[model samples]
Target: MNRNIFIANRLREVLLNGHWIANTNYKEQLSDISWQQAIQQINELNTIAALTYHINYYLRGLLTAFETGKLEISDKYSFDLPEITCKDDWDKLIQDFVKNAACFIEKIEQLDVEVFEKPFFDEKYGSYLRNIEGVIEHSYYHLGQIVLIKELIAQ
Candidate 1:
């Protein structure tokens, strides 16, 4: 298998299905959470819905980059999570998250391996390979936070 394909598969595993480290991926972690629980704010920590939106925001940006060779996302606006007032809203968010992630994986799979060797956008941002790996790493970091927040909410 191509190395890029392998990495993309790993991305899918971490984002959509089971992963070795956490034994649970984003979707699995969110599977049982209710809308009320998703929007519940514990202390000052971000809600589950917020984190879900945040994850998809970056993923969507990266997907755009891969498809159009340009990225338009900024960190300042990444966490501007939409309000989730009911179960349908939460469900739509989750559905969009899953759809975006799958699209990202597909784009990665279609990428020429040489693209990974090139700079992502600018020299300071590093190579496409680095950014792709960073995205996966970032997801795991937030996944851990989401797990902890869920536990705290449960207690």
Candidate 2:
């Protein structure tokens, strides 16, 4: 397959439906938890809700850049998750997360295959391929955390 489709598939593998790598994707994990479960704090680690917001933050930022050619997201603000005080709040965050992940994947699949080799917003960030892979890797990193946190919360 072409690189764009291949990259989009990898993005979906981690964020959406594919289960080859983690045996669980974000949608599956986040969907199974309750709002109270998501916001529960466990020691020094981040809450599941916080991690979810953090990952969605980057996905939304990257989607913006894909649509407008402007990368305005700052790492400093990525973790600024508003209070998810109720089921409605958590549900809204999950809804937005799923929508943004779909949009991010659609943006990737629409890219010209050649754009993968181009710098992503800036040369300092390396190629588009690099950043896309970073998202997959980063998502897995937090997915693992979320899984373990869920397990602990159950204990």
Clash count, candidate 2: 0
Highest lDDT: give the candidate number: 2
Residue 70 displacement (Å), model 1: 1.5
Locate the minimum summed-lDDT window of 10 residues in model 2: 61-70
Best by TM-score: 2
Model 1: worst 10 consecutive residues (lDDT sum): 63-72
TM-score of each: 0.95, 0.98
lDDT of each: 0.90, 0.94
**Model 2 global lDDT (CA atoms, 0 to 1):** 0.94
**Model 1 lDDT per residue over 48-154, tens place:** 99999999999988888767877789998888988889999999999999999999988888889998989988888999899999999999999999999999889
